[model samples]
Target: MNIIETSQLTKYYGKNRGIINVNLKITEGEVFGFIGPNGAGKSTTIRTLLNFIHPTSGIAKIFGMDCTKESESIKKEIGYLPAEINYYDDMTVSDLLEYSSKFYEGDFDARTKELCNIFEVEKNKKIEELSSGNKKKTALVQALLHRPKLLILDEPTNGLDPLMQQKFFEVLKNENKNGTTIFFSSHILSEVQKMCSKVAIIREGKILKIETIDNLRASNYKKVTVEFDSAEMADEYKAEGMTSKKTRGSQAYFLYRGPVEKLVASLYRVKIKNLNIQEPELEEIFMHYYAKEEE
Candidate 1:
């Protein structure tokens, strides 16, 4: 089943566009990546999905329920970690977590304790006294306390140290193993590449591409760097499917997305001093989409 689905999902802020005709289908137990930089409508889409803000047009559904009309019910089975966390400053971490637990059914005390322990949250410390990283740890504990069916995380590793970040992803992997669908939103391509099986790349409020990580990598996009015998040779060399081309003196770098033999045939004509061809990283692939959009 599609754990999350959106159909032509759109949002606007007065006259400004937030997301336009954004569609997504995430099946149960999938670790889906929603990738985009800041101001790329990642947060707006998340807020819309949570019904924290109503969509200007289209529809969003979670677990087959309307996001707007059935948000209360939908939220019950979802855990959310917003990009920015805000809690009652005067309350202790323990107190805040206790208050949050009152909204959900069942005994979550044991779960809360376990999460706090795992995240190293200081229960007695006031929220105001916590550092940014500690605050994030507290939020992590709160979000995972109930062990919801779906996890919606937005820039979840922002303030975490390297050790904590490792721990965080490990925890997420375990959650996915237990059949909890994860919606990981971030601008960090490496993080998405590490955790997600499939990813949707968004820019300027539109989804540019959606594909499995393996398929994306296997899309025949190659990062080719060629060093010619002279600057003139570097400048004159060109081939089909070459894009985002740049040349400096005797070196030329470009992304090629065509048959390797064709690229080899093209290169055979040039006085190539050295050549390097490798699969483009997710970041590079992401930039290729942005470049296309801009063009």
Candidate 2:
């Protein structure tokens, strides 16, 4: 089942474009990644899906209900953590959480306590007195407290330290294990690579590509680095399908997407000191997409 779907979903802010012809279908129980740099419309797409903002054109549905028409009903099943959080300043963390809980019907005390303990949120502190990280923790706890079936997280780990980030990821993994559908949006490639099975890359308010992580890594792209015996050898060597190539002193680095034998044959004639070849990271693959767009 598609837990979330959008068709030609476009949004504009006055004369500026927000997202154009954006289409997505996220399946149930999948950790779907929405990735793009700032101003690429990641947030706009998310806000549209949540019906926090109305789309100028196109359709968006969550769990088979119209986003704009059925937003209040849909929101009951969604736990959202926005990139920027706003809470009543004078309210204590516990008080704010309690207030949030009232919107839904359930006994969330156990879940709320579990999330607070995991994130180390200070429940007694007023929203105004908490550090940025602490405030983020409190927001996280509030988001997860209701045990909603869908989690829409935008830059969810922004204020967390390394340890807390790891804890957060672990919690997300557990949530996914329990069949929660997660829509994770961020510019951080590494975290997306870690948590998502499939990702959609958006640029300039348009989706450039959507592919599974394994398929993307297995797309025959390899990160190759060679240390030649001399700078002349490094400068002179070139292989088929080499891109983003660079040479520094006696070392050359590039991405190769052709036959490995062809690359090895090209290297055989060169006096190479050392050679390293590995699968390209998600960031490298992501940059390749943008570079292609520019070209």
Candidate whose TM-score is highest:
2
lDDT tens digits, residue span 1-295, model 2: 8999999999999999999999999999999999888899999999999887999999999999999999999999999998988889989999999999999998999989889999998899899998888888998998899988999999999988999999999999999999999999998876888899999988889999998978765664888999999998888887879988899999999889878899999898877889999876545666778777789
**What shift in Å separates residue 275 of candidate 2 from its native position after superposition?**
9.2
Clashing pairs for predicted structure model 1, backbone only: none
TM-score of each: 0.82, 0.85
Model 1 lDDT per residue over 149-261, tens place: 99999999999999999999999999999999999999887788899999999888999989898876566488899999999988988898998899999999998987899
The runs of at least 3 residues in candidate 2 whose Cα sits more than 4 Å from the true structure, single-residue gaps closed, are: 220-233, 236-242, 256-287, 290-295
Q: C-alpha displacement of 206 in model 2, angstroms?
A: 0.9
